[model samples]
Each structure stands twice: as structure tokens, then as C-alpha cells.
Target: MKNILRLALRAIGVWATALSLFSAGGLHAQSFPSQPVRIIVAQAAGGLVDILARGYATELNRLWDQPVIVENRPGANTIIGAEAAARSAPDGHTLLLSNSATISINQFLYKKLPYDPERDFALLYNIASSAYIIVVNPSLPVNSLREFIELAKRKPGEIAYGSFGLGSSSHLETEYLSARTGIRMTHIPYKGVADVLPALARGDVQMALAGIQPAIPLLKAGKIRVLALTASVRDPLAPDVPTAAESGYPGLNLAGWFGFVAPAATPRPILDKISGDLAQISNRRDFKEKTIMRGGLVPLLQPPEQFAEYVREERARYSLLIKNLNLNLD
Candidate 1:
């Protein structure tokens, strides 16, 4: 009789404890942003990532009725901001607004990093994606994707391609194109994406892989000609440009993405709340018009689970591609 009583009491205590924990998580989610929230952007001010962060911050501030700040900590190829956010308290108050490089490619490029992408962060949302286009100097005798490949093949080492930096998506994607097409081109590394297009415009480099947004003005001015987009489908922003698959290279379908991530130890309830809020904001027409489409990006927001899985796949894909490229930035 005593044993039965004790077992009943023990089960009651266990249930009570679980109920308390569940209530605590619920409270945490409801009262999240009990303090001001700050988003750390790993890019300079006025860039696409920073722009998107600020736009989301505005909506988050309105939704949470709390101050939301966007802070830029750009440097070391996004390591500075990433480390900052990773080391922050795992309370969901601090978040990272990051590009694919910080989460997917940096691990493969650097042998040692201040923060571990897989271990330190929980992906909250994938905000948007941009198309990467292959552009070349208008002076170059290439009007089509096939013509560009033929030119690169004929010229071999004589043709030069500019990238944001060594081991950047621009560089690796360009290299991927070369490897697939059996062509050779010189790689000229620049400071950032902003620099690569201008260099190509001035004929400092004959070709470049750059985002469509930044290249729009240059394209309008006839400074550069787009050969093909490294995307599977043509973006609505530039529907006339053929995708690399349509251009006969199905392997170059990578797109540039931005996402929100927080420290791994954040409570599940808080993570879910933020994810839900952001997903709602992303679907708003104002967000699509003022933030995404204006930046020449498409809204590609996904649920936290889907975002996490996508990040995992991208990390694996980049790992193999970087390995094949023999990139070891240290």
C-alpha cells in the first residue's frame, strides 16, 4: 500500500514539474522582448542585408511594442558579427541577420572560426534570396551564355573574372562555371560585391558574377551585359534573363540568401514566437514591396524547421564544393 502511494506521488510530482516548465516557456514567449531587441547584421550599413534587417526591425518593433535595433558589425567576412551574436545571451533578445556566407560557406573557408555555425546558432527564418547573374564587359564579344563559354574557352587564361573576394560565392560560382564548361579564366579578387561590378565595368576585369540588384544601374547604362543567371528559374525582377539551366548549365543554380538566427540555447517557445512573427511580417504586402522587391530580392521566407533543414543542406553542399575547389583560407 505504501509503495503504491509513493509511486502515485512521484508521478504527480513529475507531471507538476512538466506543467511548470511548459507554463514557464509559454510565459517566456508571451513576454519576449521584455527588453529592447537588437539584430546584429554582418554587413556594412545601406547594403542589402542591412537594409532588410532594418526593415524587419521596424515591423518587429511594431509587433512587439518594443524597441528593435539593427547593428552592423561587418568585417572579417562576417566573423565579427557572427561571433558577437553567438556569444550573446541565449535569451532570443540578440539575433543575427546574416547572409549565406556566415552560416554555410565560412566553415569550409576558414579552418578555425570564433563561433561554430552548427553548434552556436538556431536558424529562425530564411528571409529572402537574390539571383546571381553572370555579367561581362559590353566590349567583350559575348551576347549569349554559349558565346561567353566559347570566348572563355578560346581565351583560356587570357579572360579574367572578378569576385567579391577569395572563396566568396562569387568566386566559387565563377570557378564552378569554369570547371563545368572546361574553360579557364583569371580570378581577380576584390574587397566586396560593390567593387566587383565596377571593376568589370571599367574593364579592370572582363567578367564577374554579381547580384542583379547592384548590376541594374550598370546594365541600364550599357556598362555590362548579363550572360546568364546562376539560378534555376528567372527572377520576376529580371524575367528576360535566362537561368543557367535554360542556358544549358543546370549545375549553377545557387541563389544568395539572408536569414535570421539566434543563439542555440534560446528557449523553444521564444524561438517559435520570433519565427512566427517574422514569417507573418515577411508575408505582408508592405514588406514585399518596401523591403524585398525594392532590393531586387524575392521573399523566400520559410518556417523554422524548413529553414534549419535548408541551412543543413546548404552547408553540406558548400562543404563539398569548397573541398573540390581546394579553398583553405585558414
Candidate 2:
């Protein structure tokens, strides 16, 4: 009888604790972000991701009537900041403004990550995406994609390409192109975009896959020729530049995307609210124009559920591509 009573008391205690936790969670969800919110950007300031985060912070602060501060914690290919965000409380007060590197590609490129991309965070919304431009020196005598391919075939190992770094999106995409087209272009690695631009201009490298922002001014000044852009459709900013799909290379569809996320256990209502607000902001005419001017495309705003699904698809797609290409940081 004593043992029976003791077990019965323990069961009652467990039920009461569960009830209290549920009630507190409900109350916390009801009044989320009672304090200023912090957004962690996994890159250094002045980069594309940092620019987007600051812009969004301005709007988010106005909408929520609370301060939203963005903190840059760069290094380790964004794993440092990502792990910090993942370990934050699930009250929606701490958020992450992550890019393709942190959320999707890093999983396949790195041998081990401190945080699990899929398990540690809930997707809120995808803010924007941008494409890369395949640019070569104007003196190369290749103006069109077909012409470029023909020239590449003729030169083979002589046609070299430069990227920001090994295992970077540009590097992987170039490798993908080489594999698809059966052309072996020499791979030239650079420290960053700063080095890439000068190298291309000096003819130190024959060609490169660069973000549209860096290539736009150079292309317009007649310094380089744009063979094709890596987007599903032609960029309005550079409508004359054909997409890779139209250039007989439909497999070369890669774009850099940015999005927001909170800890996975965050309440659904909070995530929905953030998603809805971002959807409104992304469609504003002024916001659209600014995004275009910055060489980015305002993404088609997706609700929380749709955004989650989109990330999952991206994760799977990149995972397969990375494995097949044998891409790794080390």
C-alpha cells in the first residue's frame, strides 16, 4: 500500500509540472518579445546579408514598436553566429538573418556543424535572392553563351575561371558547368571579391562567376562581357543578359537567397506574425526599387509553412549537388 501511494504521488507531481509548463508557455506566447529583440547576422557588416538585415531591422522596429538590433558575428563560414542563434531562447526574442551559406550549403561542405540547420531553427520568411553573372574580359572575343562554350571547348584547360574561394557557390557552380558541358576549365581561387575583380580586369583570370552587384558597373563600362546570368528568368536590371537556361544550360540555376529564422520551439503564432509583416514589407514599391538597385530581387513572399517547405527543398537540392561535386571546405 505504501509503494502504491508513493507511485501515485509521483504521477500526480509529473502531471502538475506539465500543466504548469504548458500554462507558462501559453502565457509567454501570448506576450512575446516583451523586450528588445536581437537579430544575429552571420557575416561581417557591409556584405549583402548585413545590408538586408539592417534594412529589415528598420522596418521591423517601426512595425513592432520595439528596438530590433542586428549583431554581426562573422567567421567559421557563418557557423559561429549560426550556433549562437540556434542556442538562443525559443521565445522569439532572438532571431537569425541567415544566408545560403549558413542555412543550406554549410551542412554539406563542413564535416561537422555545432548546430543542426534543420533541427535547431524554424523558418520565418525568405526576404530576397540574387543571381550571379558569368563575365569575361571584353577582349576574349566571346559575346554569347554558345560562342563562349565553343571557345572553351577549343581551349579546354587553357580557359580558366576564378572564384572567391574553394567550395564557394561560385566554385561549385563552375565545377557543375565543367561537368555538364564536358569542358575542363582551370580553377583559380582568390581571397575574396576584391581580388576577383582586379584579377579579371588584368586578365590574370580569363573569366569568373560573380554576383551581379560587382559585375554590373564593370559590364556597363565595357570592361567585361556578360555571357549569361544564373537566374530562372532574365534579370530586369540586365534584361539583355540571357539566362543560363536560355543558353542551353538549364542545369546552371543557382541564386543566393536570404531569410529569417528563430529557434525551432518558437510558437507558431509568433512566426506567422513575423512572416506576415515581412511579406508586406517586401512588396512595398520603395523596397522593391531599392532591392533592384542593390542588385537583388525581392522574393515572392511565402507564409511560414511555405517558407519552411522551401528551405527543405533547397537543403535537399544543395546537399545532393555538394556530395556529387565532392565540395568540402577542408
Candidate 3:
């Protein structure tokens, strides 16, 4: 009995000593900015992701009273940038601006990813959510989403739609819609949204699911008509445009979300501080009006635990959808 007690006492002593050896997640939260903060943007400069990254960096620089820089690593559909951010030190100084493609959809599109989004990083916040507008050529007699669907049914496979690429949300969203609605539309893939928008205008494709910001120019110029949004609710920016749910298909929520993430081991205290700061930025009325609202998006600032749960749900949802669509791009 004494020998067993002695062994147990020895193990306890070692554990106590190890506990005192170093700090874990929360100890350094108070003085965290030990250096400048770097935000790794996974998209090219001038895009919405880059624009939001710069905007947040600017605001965070002011809040931290330290320089915050953004480094763009746009390519390979966000794999390069995501891997860089995942490989970064978990000191809360390096943050990756992520989108649905990186956090959720990539697992379905590719056979394997270099970094595991759930294991390699901690989701900080879901900045905002935006949905694609289902736009059709004005020449068609489809002013409403219902009319458009009915027309597609009448002329199955005759209504052609364009997307950024084969594995893109634009393409997959339409595929899912077609499957659910029992209609067929020809798929025309383009290099990017810039390339596809003109195709949509020229009627090379009869329709497209496009972003609000890009669709604004064509919408104003009378080049295309937005029938409905992929979001569950109508957009406040364009109140006239109804959502898919409002238009009769309640299961058609294909909204794209954006967020920031740090390496998985990043301290919770530091993550909370950053999340608080981002919430502050997101709450600014003028900021919302100028940035988020202008692009037809609403701020969706969620806590770390909530955001993590959201990511998991999104991943599962997309995984099933991708498998059902049989979309294996890579």
C-alpha cells in the first residue's frame, strides 16, 4: 500500500511541476500584440474578400494601436492561402480571411485538402453572409422566379446558365436548384465572374447566379433582371427582389459567408478580444451602410463556439450536397 501511494504522490508532483512550466491559451491575452498583426487574405486585391480584409485590418490597427497588414495570396481556389494560414504560428497574430470555399466546400470539391479547416484553425467570426441573385436575360418573358422556372421546365436543357467555373458555387447552386425543381439548364463555365457577366449580358447564357455587387451594374443598365435571391430572406438593398424561399422553394438557401480564422491553438482569450473588436466594427452604423449594406449583405457576428458550430453544420451540409451532385472538381 505504501509503495502504491508513493507512486501516486510522485505522479501528482510531476503534473504540478509541468502545469507551472508554461502558459497555455489565456495567460498572455492582456498583452497580446507583442508584435504587429498580419491578416492573410485568400483572394486577390480589389475583390470583396480583400476589401473586407483591408477594412477590418484598418479598424483593428486603430483598435490595437499597432500596424495590421494584409497579404494577398490569391490562387488555387483558396488552397494556397489557407495552407499558409494554417501553418502559421498559433500566437493570434496571423489571421486568415476565409470564405465558404475554404472552410466548408473545399472538402467536397477536392479529394483532399492540404490543411484540415476544422483541425488546423479556430473560426473567429462570420463577418457577413451574401447570396447569389438568379438573373435572367430581360428579353425573356420571365420577370419573376416562378415564371423563369416554368419556362425552364417548358424548354428543358434550353435555358443555359453561366458560372464562374465548374466547381464554383454558381454552378453547384444551379445544379442543386435544377435537381430539386426537376428542370435542366445547360452549364456554361467561365474563368471568373468578370468573364461570365458579359456572357450573361450577351445572352450567351440565358441566366446566372451572380453576386450583388457585380450584378448591380448590369441591373442598373437594364442588361439583366434579378429574379430571386438564394438567401432565405429578401435583401434589404434590393427589397424588390424576393428570396427563393419567398418564391416557393424553402430549401434553396445557398448563401455564401465570409469569416476570419486563426491557427487552432490560438488562445481563447485573444480570440475573444478579436471577436469583440470585430463586433464593434460590425456594429458601426456607418460602416454597415457603406460596406455591408451596399453589397446586399447583413452582418452576422457570432461567438467563437457558435461560429465553430456553424462551420461544422455548413461543412456537413455542403458535403452531402456535393456528393449528391457528384461534383468532384479536383
Off by over 4 Å in 1: 1-21
Candidate 1's TM-score reads 0.86
lDDT of 3 by residue, 148-246 (tens): 989999999998898756566667778999998889999987654666778889989989887787678889999988999988777777878888988
Q: 105-130 in candidate 2: lDDT tens per residue?
A: 78888777788988898888877776
Clashing pairs in 1: none
TM-score of each: 0.86, 0.79, 0.82
Whole-model lDDT, model 2: 0.78
Candidate 3 regions exceeding 4 Å error are 1-28, 137-141, 154-160, 164-166, 188-206, 245-250
- RMSD for each model, in Å, please? 2.8, 3.9, 3.3
User: What is the descending lDDT order?
Assistant: 1, 3, 2
Worst 10 residues of 2 by lDDT: 291-300
lDDT minimum window of 10 residues, candidate 3: 18-27
Query: What RMSD value applies to candidate 2?
Result: 3.9
